[model samples]
Target: MSTLSTSLFYGGLGILVVGLLLPGWDTATLPRRAVKRRIYWGATLVALPVLFAAGWPDVQSSLAFTAMACVLMGGWAYFRTPNIKVGGRIITADPSHREPDPTPRGGGRP
Candidate 1:
């Protein structure tokens, strides 16, 4: 890879890694960000892969990008979806069933 392509690839990777490694990146445990925000991230990350795929030789370069896409999409999904999703739809606004429950539940007590 030429210096330019190398820089671009690493730059993209760095951007993705920084975004993913943020304090709350443990997607399974994170609260949903705004759907619009997720859309932006999803579009962005997905686009990056295509861009990188064009410049790089590996197909796996897109994996992280796709994973991030999933995370953002997931956030979008959970935005209004209460936790404990039953069947295939959101049925409750119980608040407690939501993610990142604002008030931390006491361990195995609450």
Candidate 2:
């Protein structure tokens, strides 16, 4: 991987770590969840180009790897994050949906 791609990969990895940890840092801070979710998505967004750049030697292989990475990461995110509700139903963290909840409701104490 080129220096740029490597940097991006590491940066993305760092963001992913932060995103994964944010929720544990605080439960009451909705902003933290938002930030974590943003970081996770941002890392995935950055990964696309980096994956292309990193795997440029073989376009097809690179694309495949990129797609796989996206799917796996997305799947992981979808099953991991707490407070994630799907299809109007609440689902606990399942190591599958790590992605932040998409809905924007319920940020304060009930």
Candidate 3:
């Protein structure tokens, strides 16, 4: 193996170690969100070594795809969940729910 590939492989392994050693709050309890986070992060870390080992092209494509996916998902989620202020509290407004009047006294001016 070339020196660059060797370094990348080792570097990926190092990242994997760092990821695994990092403390995760509430992960031990196996909550749904925690497990999902771990799975996604773990997969990314593991993919680093494999992509690095595979060569630069694979790494480039993988990174581009990941970045694109993140941006698209972020924008989609941002628009999909619209937040509404109700009685001084911010809450997500569901499609089936109607927002209450913001004016004081059920429609009177504040």
TM-score, per-candidate, Cα-based: 0.34, 0.53, 0.32
Name the lDDT value of residue 33 in candidate 3.
29
lDDT of 3 by residue, 4-110 (tens): 76566556555544544454333333433233335446645564545445355566754654454445434432344322334644344355323332333333332
What digit string (tens of lDDT, one per residue) describes model 2 on residues 3-101? Answer: 765675566555455544554222443444554656666666766676666666768856875786677667666566544445645455575545444
Rank list by TM-score: 2, 1, 3
Better of 1 and 2 by lDDT: 2
Each candidate's number of clashing pairs is 1, 13, 0
Pairs of colliding residues, candidate 3: none
lDDT at position 52, candidate 3: 49
Best by the lDDT measure: 2
The segments of candidate 2 whose C-alpha lies over 4 angstroms from its true place after superposition are: 1-30, 82-110
**What lDDT does model 3 reach?**
0.45
> Candidate 1: lDDT over CA atoms?
0.47
Shift in Å, residue 74, candidate 2: 0.8
